[model samples]
Target: MISAPPPRPRDTTFGRSTPDAMQLSPDIPTVELTSLLGGGREAVILHNGERYRLRVTANDKLILTK
Candidate 1:
């Protein structure tokens, strides 16, 4: 008796399993703290009617506080 051929691999070309879904946005918008704070070390960001403070710590790391 003849056996059946091996099954083909699943096609993921048109699915989110492709690498395209794992890539970052090509044109990501960014804000420079120096410009936003005008030579200061902190700035407030208003989003969706909420206030969030973005600051640089003494050790030079960023911190976001609500």
Candidate 2:
């Protein structure tokens, strides 16, 4: 006896030509360090009852610590 071929995957694109239509949100929320710190070198962020320190070093690099 001959067996049938496996079925092809369904198309979830909904007839859209470009894949960009499947994207959720086009924009992301962002915060600049200088703005968050208010021109200061360091700032503290409280998340989920934990404290995180964000700082800018003399070498112009960002550092985050718990």
Candidate with maximal lDDT: 2
Candidate 1 structure lDDT: 0.79
User: Candidate 1, residues 4-65: lDDT per residue as tens digits?
Assistant: 99999985554364456545676976565688888999999999999999898998778899
Model 2 per-residue lDDT tens digits across residues 1-66: 999999999878754656565665658655666788998999999999999999989986789999
Error of 2 at 59 (Å): 0.5
Against the unseen true structure, what C-alpha lDDT does each candidate score? 0.79, 0.82
Off by over 4 Å in 1: 1-24
Residue pairs in steric clash, candidate 1?
none
Error of 1 at 57 (Å): 0.2
- Models 1 onward score TM values of 0.57, 0.57
